[model samples]
Target: MMLIEETAVPETALPVAQFKAHLRLGTGFSDDDVQDAVLTSFLRAAIASIEARTGKVLIERIFSWELVAWRTGYGQALPVAPVKAIEDVVLRHMSGSEEIADPAHFRLEKDTHRPRLMPVGTVLPPVPSGGAVVVRFRAGMGAVWGDLPADLGQAVLLLAAHYYEYRADTALGGGCMPFGVTSLIERYRTVRMLGGGVM
Candidate 1:
């Protein structure tokens, strides 16, 4: 009765050893980090299930534009509009709620670029499935904002799972492995690559 029930196909079972290795490489927490550990486990399982079902990996791009205007005591300071752009490149491979699938994929792609640095008119790389998912994700950015609510921790876990699936898929597809797991991984990698290793 699940949404993906009809389309679910038996997947090549994920190897336990490989899964554990992936967990180690993808996350920085230890087993003592109960919250992170649990979340990571959930993400891995969800990703494995989704990959087993769909032979093709779902790839997506993530982009965002933010315009803010502040007023000073003076004559408005020429509007002072500051435009910031960010991305959260992600791949949604986990077969979970359909609503999340789109957003998950988007976060994967957006994670690739340096926020507020990529030029406004820069061209983006094409994603699988003709970019439909990416377009939808970008359009839904407003909804994904805010603290990922503590009550919605389970939902966050599901999103994390889809993210992991995307990373595995991209790696298998001959793309460079993401810095770690989700867009956060890209953040860490970007910083390190820029010569800002651990403060």
Candidate 2:
């Protein structure tokens, strides 16, 4: 299976000013604006890292996932949480033909941490001989910064501050999560079920 981001979170959606406030960086400094651009990168990186580790999108964006088959006949568990909508499902046949599944035939069983695509009736569309199914959808808390969970927002600011302070370190290892950041996002880590199902 492969998951690809269809659209990225807009920079405007990032709460840079609020993050700065969290860091206690006063706006009176001459370099405040310059620092904002630099800090924006840190915030974006922190948010991306947190999302990667947690398997949860902290901001709204489109994502497409490809799979050979469903985990169960009932439905397939999506990789990301808080799925807002199922954009479309495309079936690719071994013969190289493609068809878009009718949205009416399937529905999103939205959940806070796990969402699944469930067929409306007894069975889903016929599977292709060798090709895969591509499902596209939107997921996240919301498009705006204020829509983020308070703890998650705090975690992003804390982690970004960490990155900002260590900007001169030059040799920090990748995937390094500070204790506080981990504590904030630990509960969000997704636990997959048997047969590649997500819990």
Candidate 3:
């Protein structure tokens, strides 16, 4: 299985000013914007890290996920949470043929942590032998920073600040996350059943 981001979060959707305020950086200077680029990068990194840890998307974007088969013939759990819509499902055959599943045949089961793509009927359209299914959809809390839950928004700012503070600290090692950020996102993490099957 492979999940690809069909569209990235727009820079305009990011809260650079809010992040700067969270960091308490100096203002009114002619070069106040000098650090804006750096800050933006950190914010993006923090957002990515938090989202990955929590299986949630803070900003809205399109994604294309390709899989060889459904986890359960009934439906497949989406990789991320709060999916807004299922745009299309395309079946690609090994013989170079493609079949677009009708949107009416399937539905989106919305969940905070483990949304799923379900069939409206008894089963999802079957993929041909040696073929793949590509599911395209939009997932996120919302389009703007304000659309995020308060705790999540705070977590992003806090994590971004952490990155900014440790920008030059090489000894920190990899995958290092602060307790505060982890706590903030813990409730959002999905609880998997046997071998990651959603309960």
Q: What is the overall TM-score of model 1 with all chains considered together? A: 0.17
Poorest stretch of ten by lDDT in candidate 3: 190-199
TM-score of each: 0.17, 0.89, 0.95
| Model 1 Cα lDDT, one tens digit per residue, 34-124 | 4444545654455433322321112111222211211111111110001122223222223421222232222221222221222122223
Against the true structure, what is every candidate's RMSD?
19.4, 2.0, 1.2
Q: Per-residue alpha-carbon lDDT of model 3 for 97-146, expressed as tens digits? A: 99899888889999887888889999888887899999999999999989
> lDDT of candidate 3?
0.89
Evaluate model 2: give its TM-score: 0.89
lDDT of each: 0.28, 0.87, 0.89
In angstroms, how far off is 100's CA in candidate 3? Answer: 1.0
- How far residue 56's Cα lies from its native spot in candidate 2, in Å, is 1.5
Q: In model 1, state the lDDT of residue 30.
A: 70
Regarding TM-score, does 1 or 2 come out ahead?
2
lDDT of 2 by residue, 1-199 (tens): 9999999889899888887788887788677787778888999899999998888899999999988887776788898888999999999988878899998788999987778888889756656768889999999988999998888988999999998888889687877879999999988887766755744
Task: Give the lDDT of residue 106 in candidate 3.
Answer: 89
Clashes of 1: 14
